[model samples]
Target: MTTTERTAASYFLPSDEPLGLVFPDGAAADAPALPMPADDVLLRLYRGMVSGRRFDTQATALTKQGRLAVYPSARGQEACEIGAILALRPQDWLFPTYRDSMAVVARGVDPVEVLTLLRGDWHCGYDPYGANVAPQCTPLATNTLHAVGFAHAARAKGEDTVSLALLGDGATSEGDTHEALNFAAVWKAPVVFLVQNNGYAISVPLSKQTAAPSLAYKGVGYGMPSMLVDGNDAAVVHAAVEQAVARAAAGEGPTLIEAVTYRIESHTNADDATRYRERAEVEEWLERDPIARLKRYLTDHGLLTEQVQQEIDARAEDEASALRERMNVDTVLDPAELFEHVYAEPTAALRDQASELAAELEERA
Candidate 1:
């Protein structure tokens, strides 16, 4: 049999082995070849992934230490987040879920600002106007509808902008997701629904979430095209998003991309996956970590060396340390500012309440 056929057959078997662009350790040598990326872009992707991973780890630690209220760790899904965000233009809008801090970071958000939201100091960590990223949606699958509406607005205004809404696999079960899909398809909105299928939603696995074989095919019912990409492979994720963004910009209808990836960590600080899944399952996914796969890919292609990897690791660690220092010092938010942005012109009742809050704080001080 040919190499491609052999590779396909190997993955076709029912095994706990993960499916994605890059193969696991034993399967790496037999995996299909990947396209070569420009040296600079490849290095940048590597550094971004490294930085995001470090930031995720540090943020989780902060949550544990009570420096932040709560944080979601996207440890294994960094490739999918950074790869997709890096493929977008500055003018494009990003609708990210709670687990998508990495995408926000890739889109030029400061790490300290992201921590602000987790610290409960702000509704959104960064100003959407500055970063072109919307306030992260805590309600699952609801942001898909918002993205469609924003895309529709952009089209009506004759602007060339695409909206990318990132959601998780578990979110597919929500009514809003399907509603957004129907609306985007009907109106031909310039939106891409990026579903990061990380195996489980909290404790529920994909099998319990839906009957569909793959999440991407759900777009077919809405009369929109879709594709499944190896979310763990930065190259594949980037290429897939690049095509979807181009298509949306060119006035094509929306595209739904189900990026097949795994979450190596808990769903959030509030979750404990150990209750529903085995330690072996977690260990298995750790073996196919996305960051390590990309690192190997870069090293094999001569784009990264041991010294370069060390430097990247060091840089990420330093950035995380600095971010923690800044977040620690800047955690406080003015009680007045919360009421300040509540309305363009505060209603009589709101104004009275704001005054009362101010008076109370002043008395306490």
Candidate 2:
């Protein structure tokens, strides 16, 4: 084949329709070789999703009780939250956004520690180095660059590592997203970018965010392969992310996945989603709930017994109860620690400011 033909054949295009293994009604799609994971793996994904949603509910309650400063709930996006992380191996890195606390917990980070940032206690609750997960990024799309850089470094060291960076639809408009995609494509970095298109970026709808047909279409501009998946379908998202990860592990560069999901709740406790969208719209997305859909599919296939359901629900409740109790306790924090990791070496001006802040706290005490 000619060089041009070879290049043309290499480019993997985004799906004409979002790839989905199950319908919104929870019926598994008709297929010969379905991309569904093994039954045990499916049960694990289902359990993670159930726990994630449980955590989301508890965190939202904390926000109302004024324990957490703020929380971006991934209520309706449980499939995306759990499934994507399930695709990763122990060594693969995860770079999550502020809205992806559920995904962080699904990655095995402590549920309480996962809320550390929202608790107004520390920058990050869990140690990033302890696992391959990075701090939950609040800035739009910046973590994509970090993921790309880390993937490049891993490749440089001749290690088989892949990084998955999660972001919202609104972040795709940011320059950092563009830079990360371009850089990853050029360098063949082992990374996967999962854009959770939850219909809105805070109050801004996707209609106002970008003119592209779908965020996955942006991959074409960067010469990167892309896939579009039903983010609410755990099996579909898990299968697609696994495919992308396997491709990246083979040194084939990055893949952009746009998971079409919805944000059932308001952007945050502070923002009113009613200002920009209608209640009917929210009601519609709630019917397509990821957790319920998976539960139905598993039950139909006889994979989910009543005993299994009760066991998963019990475990989830335990986590929520623990989160509620822990959040109720007061946290003692040291203001001086804010300057601890601000720089490799504390600058003279930074030290002076830190000292002044310390003295001010001491005087107040």
Instruction: After superposing candidate 1 on the true structure, give the runs of residues whose Cα lies further than 4 Å from its correct spot.
Output: 1-21, 25-37, 362-365
TM-score of each: 0.89, 0.96
Please give, for residues 262-343, the per-residue lDDT of candidate 1 as tens digits.
8888888888888989999888878767778877877777778889988998999899999878866745567887776678
> Model 2: how far is 62 from its true place, Å?
0.9
**Candidate 2 per-residue lDDT over residues 113-170, each given as its tens digit:** 9898998888888999887889999999999999999999999999999999999999
Ten contiguous residues with the weakest lDDT in model 1? 10-19
